[model samples]
Target: MIERLSIIGVGLIGGSLARALRAVGQVGEVVGCGRSGPNLEKAVELGVIDRFTHDPGEAVVGADVVFLAVPLGAMRGALSAIKDRLDASAVITDGGSVKGSVVADAVAAFGKVPTRLVPGHPIAGTECSGVEASFAELYRNRRVILTPLSETEPDALSLVSRMWEACGAEVTTMSVGHHDEVLAATSHLPHMLAFGLVDALARMRENDEIFRYAAGGFRDFTRIASSSPVMWRDICIANREALSAMLARFGIEMTDLAESIRRADGDHLLEIFERAKAARDRYVDRVK
Candidate 1:
């Protein structure tokens, strides 16, 4: 169990982890650190954290576990701020969506990927933000991927894995590059497409009518477009290499679909749709 857990950025992911740890009695004290006083205070009032602070260094002073849950862009600064204050035995981890860049940021901040630093990403979230959007059950049955570097200590990795497991998450490990590439294709690209589609539709001349006539399909598809723009922007930039490649591949697929429709190639369109449906169904079944 973690005697003291410090979360640098008490937003949805961080708050949910704190709540989950508390719920399972896996943590003794939860300290939240963030730039927004109001949000940190809200996290404290919501009982997601035992205390709050604007200073990252102070927050992690004696923390046995430190979770850096800030945006990817802010990772370097957050890590730097707490690097000097972290206890010798403290285990550092992050909830960044992009792992490759996060690994680089940690190295940049500390001159190396410390054995105690474990890079992680939780494959669970809602179209919500802030502490109020968090709950203890957010990670229940969810997958938390850890990307441990060559320098990562086995004990540190095991501790983080167990922590996530205690929070009801199924832990998995993979190379940082592989994690980033997979996330770029599956998670980042979809969010990017959702945001782009919504933006394009909103700018149409018949935007009002388009929205008024929209149905559940549109709502369900674009639900993730409501995510924090700044956070998504940073993710896109951080994982640009993999994301760009995925985007190019998607563009080719879209072009093919468009041409099939233009040529009235019903067979080609049907084949593509059928394949997509089968893949999605299989994924849904596996998750269930």
Candidate 2:
């Protein structure tokens, strides 16, 4: 159990983690730190945290664990802010979608990667933002991937893994490279496609009517397009190498599919549809 926990960004992911730990009685004194004062006030009012601070350095004081839930773009600044104030033995982890950039940021900010710092990403969330959207059950039955470097302290990794497990998440560990490649294909690529499809349709003629007539399929596929653009922009840039490779392969496949459709190749279209349906059907239940 943790005595004091500091969360650098008290948004959906951070606030939800706080609530989850509170729900299990595994944590005490959650101090939320964020750029938005009003949002921090709201988190306090909602009982997501015991107190609030606008400064990351002040928030980490006396805390045994620090969780950085800020956007990928804000991570370096947050780390730099808390660098000198970090307790020598405090375990630090993050909810960044891209692990490589976070590891690099830690190295840059601290002169080297701290053995107590474990990079983690919880594979769960809605297309929502802010502390108000947080819930304790957000991570229930979800996977939380922890990427530990060779120098990472075993005790520190154990603390982080057990903390996530207490929050109802299945904790798993993998190399940072493997984690980034897999997430780029599974999560980032889908969000990119969803955003691209929605933006493309929005720019078409009679876009208003197009949206007005859009059905369940359109909404379901594009739901993630409603996610925070700033966060996604950073994610794309941070994981650009892996994400770009996936995007290139997808682009080639789309071009071939379009050409086949333009040629009125019903057989080709049927084959593609059948293959996709079979694949999705096999894995859709796992997602659900």
Candidate 3:
């Protein structure tokens, strides 16, 4: 049972956590922190947090649990700002998509206290952002990945896991490296491809009709391209190694398909298309 929880960077992820935690009675109070005064004020007005502050120190004081929900690039600064104010027994966690860098930063910033840090990535989000866009049930039935290092304290891990579970998340544990690698293929690479495709087409004056016809397939594929540039940019840089490897693999696969099409190799094309269709059908059935 967390008596008090502090959420740094109270945008979509942070605000949603605060709201969901409160809805499930997982915490006695939720304090929000953000660099923007107006965003903090809006969060309070929206009741996403019980209290709001620009000072990370003020937000974290006496908190039994703290969640760093900012962009991956802002994480180090946010943790440093609140490190001194964190309760010695407080369990610090993050909602960062990449965990390896965040965990390393935590170790460097807090030294021995890093054992209390639990890095998490909730595979739940919309193309939306800000406190106004937050939904209390955003985490419901969603997967929350906890990348706990070998040195991470079991008690601290348990506390963080319980909090996410209370928010209606299905929690799973993975190594930081493995989490980054898998997410590179599933989430990061796709976002990169979407943005790249959109940007390439945007350079053409005749492509205005593309946006006009962006309903159905185009809409679904480019949904993630509409995500916050700041957030995605940070994620890309932070998980550069894993993302680069995945991108290289993706390029090889794309080349194979392109060659097949160029050669009019019907059998090869059919094999690739059939496998992709079957995989997608399996995933859809399981999800349903």
* Estimated TM-score for each candidate: 0.99, 0.98, 0.97
Q: Write the per-residue lDDT of candidate 3 for residues 1-288, one digit (tens) a residue.
A: 689889998988999998898787777888888889888889888888888888888899999999999899988888888888878898899999999889877867777548889999999999999989898899999999999888889999999999999999999999999999999999999999999999988887978987787779988898899999999999999999999999999999999999999999999999999999999999999988
Off by over 4 Å in 3: none
Across 178-245, the per-residue lDDT of candidate 1 in tens digits comes to: 99899998999999999999999999999999999999999999999999999999999999999999
In model 2, what is the error at residue 259, expressed in angstroms? 2.0
RMSD of candidates 1 onward, in order: 0.8, 1.0, 1.2
lDDT of 2 by residue, 226-286 (tens): 9999999999999999999999999999998999999999999999999999999989977
Clash count per candidate: 0, 0, 0
Candidate models: Cα lDDT each: 0.94, 0.96, 0.90
Q: Report how far off residue 274 is in candidate 3 (Å).
A: 0.3
List the lowest-lDDT window of 10 residues for candidate 2. 279-288
TM-score of 3: 0.97
